[model samples]
Target: MKKILTLSLLFIGLHTYAQKAKLELNLQKDSTYLLSVAADMDIDQLLNGAHQLVKTTVTGTTAHKVTAIKDTLYEMEVTYKKLGMHIQMGDKEMGFSSEAGADDLMSKVIKIMINKPFIITMSKRGQIVEVKNIDSLFSGMAKEFPQVGELQLTQIMAQMKQSFGEKSIKGNLQETFVIFPKAPVSVTGMWTTLTTMDAAAISVKTLTKYTLDAITDKYYQVSGAAVITPDKVPAFKQSNGYFMRLTQATGNYTAKLKIDKTTGWVTESHITKNISATMQAKKTATGPVELSYPMKIAMKFTGSDK
Candidate 1:
C-alpha cells in the first residue's frame, strides 16, 4: 500500500507540472473593451554644470471595438476617449487635457483627437498588422489650423506623425498585446520577443523575455525583463539651430502583468524603465559637448470589458 501511494503521488505531481494554458485574444465579435494607461517620467540632466530635473505625466483612455473576425485576423475600431499630459520643469508647470477648451495649440490638437476612430487589424496572437484612417484624421486637424503657414504646418504634421503614425501606433499596441506565446505555455514557460521603438530621432530596440509565473481561475500572472539598445544615431538639427545626436544609451525594462484568462486582455499591469544616455550637442560657434542624463519611467495600465 505504501509503494502504490508513492507511485500515485508521483503521477499527480507530473500531471500538475505539465498543465498548460493557451493565451490568445478570444473576444467575441462586436465586443468592446476600454483600456486606460498612465505614465510618469522623471529626467535628471547635467547641463552647463548644473543639475536639472524634469517631470512629466501622461494619461490616456482608449476604446477598442471588435468589428469583424476574418480567418485569424481581427479588425477593431479604436478611439481615444481621453488624453492628457502635464510637464514640470523646476517650479513651472504646463499641461493640456481633452476636457479643456481649445485655448492653445495643444488643447486644440487634443480636441481634434478626441473621439476620432481609427481601424486596426490584429492577429489572434495579438500582433498589430495594420492601422488605417490616421492620415484622414490628420487632414482634418490641418483644416482646423488654417492660419498656420504651410511650412510650419508641414513641420507640425511631421512631429505629429511620429506619435500617431501607423507604425508608431502598431509599436505601442504590440507592447501590450503581442505578449502571448504562440503555443500553450505552462507555468515557468518562457518566451522572448523583439521590438523596435522610435524615440525622438533615435531608434531603440528591445528584447524581452517573458515567463508565466502563475495561473488562477481568473487571470494569468506574467513577468518580463527587457534589454534596451539604442541604434546608430543620426544627427538632428534642433529648432535653436544646434544639432544633437545620441552618443550612447543603455536601459533596463521590467513589467508585471495580470491578464484575464477568458479574453486575453490585461486586467492590470505595472512597468518600470530606467535609461542612461549621453547626447552630443554641437553648433556652428561651439564644439561638441556631451550631456549625460538618466530617465526613469513608471507606468500603470488597466483594461475592462465594461
Candidate 2:
C-alpha cells in the first residue's frame, strides 16, 4: 500500500508538469506601454600595438500608445523618451546626454529625433506590418540644418534610416515575436524562424531555432540559437573613393528570453552576436588589401505595459 501511494503521487506530479499554454498577444487597444533597449558593442581591430579596442553603449526609451484598431491589426503612436550614448576608445572617451543642443552633428540628430511621433502597425500575432511617419522626421531635420545640400542630406538620411528608422525598429520587434508559436506549446517544444538582414552591403540569412526551456506561474523561459551565413558577395563603395568586396563571412547568435505568461510580452531578453568576415579593399595605387574583422555585439531589452 505504501509503494502504490508513492507511485500515484509521482504520476500526478508528472501530469501536472506537462500542461501546455497558448501564447498570444493580450495588448489592448488605447493602452499605453513603455519600451526600452540598451545595446553594447565591442570592436577590436589589428592596428598599432596589439589590438585597438572600441567600446560603445547606447540606450533608448520610447512611449507607445495604441491609437486605432482594425480587425486584427493595431496602429500605435510612438514618442521618443530618452536617447543616451557613451563611447570609449583608448585614452579618448565621449558621452552624450539628452540635454545636448543642436550645435554639434550628433546633438543635432538627437534634437531632430526628440518628441517626434512615428506610427507602427502590427498584427495581433505580433508581426510588424509597416512603419510610417518617416518623411516628417526628415522634414524636421531639414529645418534644423538648412545649409546642408540636397545630396548631402540624402546620404545622411540613408544612414540615419538604417540605424534608427524602419529596418532597426522591425528587427528589434522581430527578436521578440519570432519566439512565439501559433499554437499551444509544452516544455521542451521547439520552433524555427528565418530572417534575412543586410550587413555591410552583404545579404545574410539567419536560421534561428528556439526551444521552450521552462514555464513558471509568471514567466515562460525560451532559448534560441542561430546560424548566420552570407547569401552573396556584393561590391560596395569605400570611404576613400575606392571599391571593396566582401570575400567571406559567417556568424552565430544565442539568445535567452523571459516572457510574461498572461500578456505574451517579453519582459527581458539578452542576446549575443558573433561575426567573422573578410573584406578586399582595392586601392587605386596599391593592388588590393585583404582585411579580416571579427566582431561581437550584445543587446538587451526591457519593457512594461501600463
Candidate 3:
C-alpha cells in the first residue's frame, strides 16, 4: 500500500512539472522559418446618412533566417516571399499579387517588394530592438517607378511608408511574438502586456491579458483578451477637400495561439477585433457632417521552422 501511494505522488509531481513552461525564443543560428500572415477587414461607414461597406484582405509570407545571436538577442534577415491584396467596395473590386504578372501599377509595385531582404534585431522575450534597411529598400522601389507623376508617386510612397515603416514593423512583430510571460508559467497562469498600434492617421493602445490554457507534449495553447482604446486620432485631409477626424473610438480584441514547446514560436494563431468609432467631416459644402464607422478585423498567422 505504501508503494502504491509513493507511485501516485510521483505521478502527480510529474504532471505538475509538465504543465509549467518557460516560454522564450530559442532560435538557432543558421536556422530559417517561414511565417504567413493574413488579415481580413470589413468597414461599415455611414457618411452623412449614406451607408457603405468595404472589405479588404491582405496576405503575406516571409522567411526569417537567423544569422547571428548575441547574448539574448537574435539578428535575422527577413525576406518577403509572397504578398497580395484584394479589396471590394460595392460593385468595384481591385486586387494585386506578387505571383501574378505585373500588369497594373499596384502589381508592379508589389512585385518590386518581393525578395527584398531586411534585418531585424529582437530579444528572446520578443522585444524588437531595430529594423534596418526597410526605408532604403522602399526608396529604391520608388526610383523604379519613374513613369509615375511626382505628386502621385509621393502619395504612394507616403502610404507605403506609413504601413511598412520601422515603427509599424516593430509593432506588428511584437503583437505576435511577445506573448510569453517574464517567468515560467503553469496552466491557467495569467499575465498582462501593453502594446500600441500607431499609424499615420490613428493610434490605438491595447492592454491584453493572456492565459496559459493548456500544455501538451509538443505545444502550449494560450488565449488573450484585450481592451483597445484610442490613443491618438489625427485629422486626415481627404482628396475631396474635406478633413476627417475620429471623435470617439472603442474596441475589443481576442486571440488564440498555439506555440511550439521547443522553439517557443507561434505555430498558429487567430485574432478577432471589433472597433466602433465616430468621425466628423469638416469643410464639406453642407458644413460639418458626422459619420459612423464600425470596423471588424480578423487575422490568421502560421509559422513553420525550416
Expressed as tens digits, the lDDT of each residue in 1-306 for candidate 1 is 999999999999888778999988888899988888888888777777777888888788899999999998999999988888889999999998888664777767776888889999999888888889987556576678989888877776666676677767877888888788888989999998887766454567788999999989899999999898886664443433455555466787888988899988887888888777776666643565544344333334443433
- In order, the Cα lDDT scores of the candidates are 0.78, 0.70, 0.78
| Candidate 3, 1-306: lDDT as tens digits | 999999999999878856668988899899988788888888777755677788888888888999999999999999888889999999999998888664888787777878888999989988788889996546566578778888887766666666677767877888888787898888888998888766544567888999999888899899999898888765453433455655456788889988888888788888887777765666664565644454444334344442
Clashes of each: 0, 0, 0
Q: Which residue pairs overlap in candidate 1's backbone?
A: none
Q: Where's the lowest-lDDT run of ten residues in candidate 3?
A: 297-306
User: Which predicted model would earn the best TM-score?
Assistant: 3
- Per-candidate TM-scores read 0.84, 0.80, 0.86
What is the alpha-carbon lDDT of model 2 when measured against the actual structure?
0.70
Error of 3 at 141 (Å): 3.0
TM-score-sorted candidate list, best first: 3, 1, 2
**Cα error, candidate 1, residue 18 (Å):** 2.5
Pitting candidate 2 against candidate 3, the one with the higher lDDT is 3
* Candidate 2: regions farther than 4 A off: 47-50, 99-103, 146-156, 199-202, 232-247, 279-306
